[model samples]
Target: MSTTPVEEFEVIIVGAGIAGCAAAKAFGTDGRKVLLLERDLSEPDRIVGELLQPGGINSLKSLGLEDCVEGIDGIPCYGYGVIRKGETVEIPYPIDPETEEQAVGKSFHHGRFIQNLRKAATHTENVTVRELTVNSLLREDDSDKVVGVSAQSKTNEYFRFYAPLTIVCDGLFSKFRKEFTTKTPDVRSNFVGFIIKDLELPLPNRGHVVLAQPSPILMYQISAHDTRVLVDVPGKLPSVSTGDLKAYLEETVGPELPESIRVKFIEALQTERLRSMPNGFLPPSANQSVGMILVGDAMNMRHPLTGGGMTVAFNDIVLLREFLSPENVPSFTDYETIAQQMNSFHWKRKNYCTAINVLAMALYRLFAANHDADLEVLQRGCFSYFQKGGDCVDGPVGLLSGLIQRPIVLIYHFFAVAFHAMYIEAKINGWSGAHLSFIMFFTVLYTACVTILPYLWSEAKY
Candidate 1:
């Protein structure tokens, strides 16, 4: 062991992913001495998990990195289009005229954005970037009081760093979680996809999540013209690799994409290894300790199926900014309470996310079943929505936009709109207007509930 000195900072951040990097940048620029640790030193690249919602966009604006969000070369996704069992509907982004332009988010090349964040963290005046592996978390007096972290850089050297607060932003499967008591994750429907270049088709600025004939499919044109396809490739058929890219494209993609572009995308896949995933999520966890904090993915996951993780992570930051006293941030007891409340926020979203995953996969399977009736059912449901300016997707979309964040209401509204669509579509397609006017009567009942329930609930609270 070389006799060196242990260094200390105001905050210590572990992990280099978006969550960790965001925390480091936030705390560092505020002039808090920060040390950011990452296991790998290489710059992050690749196109996995590229989707970003408006909440994520607002996160950047809060950090004064609005240019980083807008200037990046990502295709603008105005909203999401869902392919349902018997319906298809487009969920456009919900924006307020009141917020700054940067608060509005569009999809981007995630790898590029990561690089921009990396540069920001390392360049900040009060921040120190350390490349090393954490051996274990340090605790004081064994009473769930976290003191700091002990790590070893390569070359088998030992070093320790301490701070008033320790942050673990490590990704899902984070070893950091073991440092604190946390609930095991309940939901984990992972999503995996590949980045394709030179897509010949002029893809929509707005993305589409389709219940294609085979896998439930998610296709988007990212910040650049590069394309991403999220599909539940059969997990048993063996994980496809670059070598299998040609066969997979010929068999799976050729039929779905435009004939002219099918071969082009195949070629791009050959050049770029195409991949898929089973599911991805970071279950909500808390510090459960004194003088410790968990931020971003560390606190919760916005399942990739929903593409809401980044947005939720941003919200976590927002809550922290409001609750975390930048000037004389409170003691560990107070910090833990604030962090737990934030965790609860994402926990509610995760439940809805899991429900959406089941819903998406079910619809994808129904569409793939290719039953004519199913397609008609889906089409009619969609018609019912726009036919009456229905808010089928608005509830979830607006929540992610941060326009409406009351979790209980947000979750209730999604299911409410979905049930309403079902009733309307059923009425128009089959039920008799005279004999089954009961459906429309029930619709009135539903409308009454939707209107009065929220008020009644609020007054109850009052």
Candidate 2:
């Protein structure tokens, strides 16, 4: 049997998705030899990570990967326009007037974005983009550190590659994450995606969210002519015909969208195939054996309702580069030193990770509230609070974008929304009676516990 050649690299990154490509660009720019492996080099067409929050855009710029987002026919997202009770409110992405750079998001085809990042990595002199499938991690006889990987080329040829650092960026369905951590992601919901063509939306640069019965539906323009719509379905959906799905959207959610897009929404739903993706959250942690690191969806994930996955991944790459680059940490090449550095890096990332993760999960619950009375109230309150405008909108949007790392800020806004809902309830039902007072008290308590406590628990463990 003929054996393929063995090669070496400073860093070996698996899966050439956003995270892997970003890592390659960062490390390669620093003159470190990087091997970026991807199963397929083509642009991805599936739904997920289609939007880049302002925080993620900043992180991309920080890594010098901002060019990846440019010239991809992306739609600049100002903020979000939420529709509830036949009313629409436009909430702009928080603007930091004092700072030079303005915060904004972008929505586009996921595949194009991935292709752009891959191209960026490929253009880096020290990064080699290889279309290969990583079979497994190569470890020392008795050590837990993963020193290399065994992979196969497209032609069915096997190969071995060793590196000082191995990064797993295979994303949400990562096969290697189990080797390091036992935590399984909580499958919270699923998203159904389709494209609505040739429609002029009410808010051109805003993501449109409709609070429909059963769950919320998100609509945003991906290109000049195509708008992407994602419907959040809580739990596993039983098998239903395409006609059933079309009817569901037309009856429950399609009316909530702008009239111009209603016909297109119905048409998009008529197609035989609709792409579905599970929304999951894997508690964020920096736990990895020596010489091995996990980044992006492989390490942590959150609900996608806020479109924060790419933001988290890009920020993670920036942080990883800051800590592991020779200019910052000289011992980055050593196994023990690298392991310790990652441990410290984990704690350093606590603030941003906590804020982003909690915000995504919490926001999804609020947006996708189908049957829960308190959550339904909170959802209405959230929309009304945003309609009132000012800090209420900016602060929460900042948290969603990852520009704001303070968890307390998120807590404050969440309780404020809850309180606002309580006030509305009290006003509508009359606060004179003991029954109303008791109801108000419990509503406030329940909202606080659900929104604030889960975030606290995650932060503490983080």
Candidate 3:
């Protein structure tokens, strides 16, 4: 009987997206043979993953993949410009205290950025990328330990690949997440996207967030000539095939945009095909299964409102490489030590992940107020707090950018905004009636607690 031999490697990584490619490269650079698998190797055209925060840039550079963002017509983002009812506020990234240099982020076509990452992974020392569709995890009969994977090539040829450790980074709609955890993603809303051409933005080189009716709208230059606009549509969406989506954009969203962007938005609405993605929230869980672990969107995801997805993913890979380095564990065969390291990796990553996760969900709720009284008040307060400048703007923007990882910093500034909102309310209405003023104070404070506490609690869980 003739039998084909199954290929074996030190590590098998499923899904060659941002996290998978980075993991393969990092492990390969450390002298580990890695097999990176993806169903499609062609450039991925996506609405999200187009923007990378400054913290992600730092992590990417640390991984020695800094050149991936180059030669892609990627735009340099300095900060953000937020508009509410035609009023605008510019919030730039905080200056580095030690280096005396401004932090910079990049925005580009999602597919192009991803292709660059795939190229970097392919050129790495011991990494091999193949277009194979992973069918299922290979597990030992007597135990839950995942040994490798079974996959099919384009020609429908079946092959078995084996490794001591396997990483699942199949991304947002992962087929393998249930094998590791019971948690599922909570879909809060959806983002309808449009590509506007030759649009002159109010703030050049800065991401723009417009507080439009119903929800918030995001606009930023992905390339020299093209602008990406993502309109946040809460709950159920209008039917696209029936022209209801077009009517909603034209009748509701179009007029709310700033005058400069409104004209081009209309033009793009007519010419460009509409695209939408669900905004989901999934808290990160510790790796419990032996011989395998989940990473990237498969393991955790947050609302894309703040553009922190890539930042969290790259930073996670940086920590992962350190925890699983040769000097740390030496080999993946030692399942006990690998399990302990994975537990430590979970808690240690909270420093960066917690802030990004909590902030994204919390801010999205506030920004997409949808006529809710408390959130609307908080939204105005957030904008007004930015208008004050200094620590107010610097602190929040820093947390949002992933530069500042401390959850305490985020807590302090969040409450500060709440109190500031109360102050604004008092100023406008006056303290003429003591009873009414007292009642209003606690109401806003209560709203603040309810808005953020649940998300914080979600992060605290395993």
Candidate 4:
């Protein structure tokens, strides 16, 4: 009987998605031998992860992978245009205080950007990307420490690859996250996607968010000729196989869109095959496993409403590179040092992650009010707050765009929106009855706390 030999590497990254590719390149650039494994190396056709916020762009540049966003027909996104009822307000990203230039984000075909990242990783000095499916993590015989992975090639040949450190980047449907953490993703909604060709948007070079009934609808150009539309559908989705989804979009969502966009939306529905992805909320937990760590969607997730997933992922890579640098830890074999660093990495990352996570979930709840009177009032207040335009617009949009990392700022603005909503409500009621106004104030405040507190607590624990 012939035995298959075990191939060894300094680092083995499972899943060549955004986090895996970036991690491989970072470690390889640091002079470590890296083995990057993926099930497929072809361009991916994903609806999400196409939008890169300004902070994500900065992180990519920091990692010297800025070239990945180039030559991909990527569009520059300045900010967002929000529409409520018939009123529209444009919110542009705040200018950088240091550079004095407005921060710009990029929107491209998710697959194209990913392929570019893969190419960058492949070209790195010590990184070797292989097309393989990782079946499971290989553990030490007498311990729970992961030493490597068991994977299979396209031809069905099984092989064991060894490494001192194994990084799991298998993404949203990660099969390995269960081995390290007890948390599961809470999927409350799904995004139904469509591509409209040569569509003219109300606001060019910026994302347009329509606060439509049931939930929010997003439209942004991915290339010169194509615009991507994602409609948020909460709870159980209608049967797509039976045309219910199509009917729902046409009869329900289409009318809520602007006249300029509604025509193209209907056209796309008639011509394109609709694709949908679930919007999940998964809070980050510290890594307790010794030999392996989780990154990207596998480690954490947020609602896709803010387009902050890639921003969080790239920023995580930046911090991971720093925490695991040769200067920080001379060798990967130092499990004790690595464990301590992992704990620090978990908490330190919350500086940015917490804001994005809490905002995404909280905004989704407010935007998709679902006939909740309190949420509806808060939603109106939120739009009105944006209309105030100054610190109001800059602060909230800054958090959404990934340029701001202050959770305190987020908390303040959230409650401000609540109070503003209360004021608006009181005005509508004529402010004539003092008793009614006082009762409504506490009601709105309680609703605001209920909306954001749980998400904040989630970030605080574990």
Candidate 5:
């Protein structure tokens, strides 16, 4: 590892995740002196964020990384689907095939995406890839204005690298952000997965979220024709150090997956455990503190559902590029604040994801529920809400997307539901409980039948 500060490093980006790399690349492309740091020099391994949303493609195209992005063999995702109560509604991606439809299904391997982005960042002039483990921030004064970083290689002397502005892209649990700013990660992550890979499994080209049974399993095609299953199993979260991950892989995917995929997945889990970086996806630029700006998981951590994480990082970079574009030399302090307004899009989607995630989990639990009575309650809830387009006030998805700026709109969704639920519950009579329960239960079955029966009759309009 090289020591000594190069005259003036404009931006020091810690962590080489999508957000960090993109921001560095942007600064570099503008010909600014930048340093990109990574904890492990080795390539990133197994992780989620495999399904790149259509919106991700749109973002990448703007960054000029879209064409080669597929060079990583990312499988393009169609759209979202839900399998609830043994019924599945697979939404065929609504892209017009005449244009970029062919490229639309490219699903990104998170590790692969990181490698590709790192390649682009390092190759760009003015960007230096610092392969070392970051220990702490380089503060100029006691106020915590991040002037640079303190880092070291495996067995090398420690070095201090300085920069006027430092961007911490250090995944989630960002020590940098906590040290400098007041932005706390308020997002609570609930789902964890047993990710296993195999070559070209015999599955649909489109993605499927199987909530039909308990412990929701989300399967999507990945970088290779291989697939990754995000199986949501609940109980005491298994220990990571136990090497329990390998045995867990066998029990979860071996029996359910096809033979070839099963074999491949086994080999991957055993050999591909990421001993390096933390197992989480990247995020957009979040907090802006004086000389430090928090990007990726260090700031607004994304939910894995929509697959927009990496692309959002790219979008953040574009913003950083524009801000640092020599034509406009805003103070590094102002740059931090501007990064937030620039990434309003990501936090917007966070709002949407928060609710849909709840919906997905609740639906998964209902699908897996063996108790018929409790299930009836869930069934009624789902059947009524979806059919009515049950708006949770303004709805979380809208808020997360930044479409609805005010968070208070999410509260309205609750108030509306509260009133409606009260009216329904007040009307509950003796066996009417049984009757209403029956109606709720049957309606789901009926909706399924209607969707199926109409297509059978050639009169179904989805």
Candidate 6:
């Protein structure tokens, strides 16, 4: 067999989504050659990553990708409106008096966001974004250190590209991450996404979460006349072709939404074209290999209930840029040096990563609780807690928006909510025969075990 000469770049990044685009832009800005490969170069129109938290917006600004959200008809989201039963409470994102930064998020079409990232990445002189499907990983002998990738072009011609570092930004259903690590995604629930055009919401510039039967549903504006709705189904949903899914939505998810949004829900059902994605959770872990590292959903994932995925991915890119800046380590291919740098990167990222990742899953489990009495109270307690309008609201809102990085702070506020639930239960049932008290203790204990313990485990290990 005759061998072809290898084409070398400083870095080869697979999957040009948010993570890959950000990485390419950062490295390209630093004057490093970057090859960004994607199976489809046209814009994406998926259900996920349509909203950007305030923290994520700031991170994009820092990375010079702020223009990605502009001119896309994106709506500014001030905070979240929690609707339970028939009542609604709005919890605005925390405003810092010191910095005076706006407590706002942004919502737009997921495809537009991807297009923006691609534009920003290609704007840089050193990044070459190409449409290519990565066929397999190229390694050096049996060492398992990925040197590059063998990809097939659109024309079905095979080519080999070599680089010192290969970034697997292939996202949630990554095909390459498992070749190095053996962790299987812990699938929790499924999210079905749909869009309704020409709909108006009462809460003009805020995300609304409907706590209803079966599971929680999220509604927010993605454009002036369109609203995006996501229904969280407890498990794998039955296929729409079954002729029963629309009835299920009308029965369980439709009644929970407000009248204005409910009309749109029915309109969306006419199309019968809801896009579904599994909610997967994977703890952030360090890749011990020398030449390859994972980023974005390819590296770690959390429940999308809180919409913190983009914030975490943008922040990850920020930290990576800082640690591997041109002045710090000009050469990205130094195996030993890059390995040591990655170890430090893992430690420094624990703060925001642990907080956001754990918060998403915990909030989903609490909000999606169907028939558990304790969880029901906890859900009601959560809505009421946010209604108090002070530090009670600021604390958890800050954590949810990715502004607060301390996991201990999350612990304190979470337990406070649990105790508040106990208080509400006691007020309704009256603590007699120690029966109600026992349930309170057990409920709070269960909340702590699920929320706090997993957070500690991820933080301590990574």
- Runs with alpha carbons beyond 4 Å of true place in candidate 6: 1-5, 99-101, 432-437
Winner of 2 and 6 under TM-score: 6
TM-score of each: 0.76, 0.95, 0.98, 0.98, 0.68, 0.96
Which run of 10 residues does model 2 get worst, by summed lDDT?
Answer: 237-246
**Superior candidate under lDDT, 1 versus 4:** 4
Global fold similarity of model 5 (TM-score): 0.68
Lowest lDDT block of 10, candidate 3: 428-437
* Tens digits of per-residue lDDT for model 1, 98-190: 763323457777777777777777887788988888877787774667777888878877778988788787866668665664444434233
Give the per-residue lDDT digits (tens) of candidate 2, residues 264-382. 77787776367788888888876668878888999998888888889888888998998888866554467676777788789888778788888888887787778788887788778
- Report the Cα lDDT for candidate 6: 0.85
Q: lDDT per prediction?
A: 0.59, 0.83, 0.92, 0.93, 0.55, 0.85
Candidate 3: Cα lDDT at 277: 95
RMSD to native for every prediction? 6.2, 1.9, 1.4, 1.1, 9.3, 1.9
Model 3 — TM-score against the truth?
0.98
- List candidate 4 stretches off by more than 4 Å: 1-3
At residue 456, give the lDDT of candidate 1. 31
Q: What lDDT score is found at residue 245 in candidate 6?
A: 69
- Cα lDDT of model 2 overall? 0.83
Question: Which pairs of residues collide in model 6?
Answer: none
Question: Candidate 3 lDDT, tens digit per residue, 251-316?
Answer: 999999988778889889999999999999999999999989899999999999999999999999
Model 4 scores a C-alpha lDDT of 0.93
Evaluated at residue 180, the lDDT of candidate 2 is 74
Candidate 6, 1-462: lDDT as tens digits: 333467999999999998999999999988899999999998788998989998898899889999899999999999988888778888889877888865889999989989989988888998998888999889999788888999887777777999989988999999987875677679978898888887776677999889887689998899988888899987768678886767778887788777767877887888848778999888878869777889999889988999999999999999998887777777976778787788899888888888888888888878887887667888877777888889988888888898888878888888888888777777777775578667677866686567567756864775
Scanning candidate 1 in windows of ten residues, the lowest lDDT window is 357-366
Model 5, clash count?
Answer: 22
Which candidate has the highest lDDT of all? 4
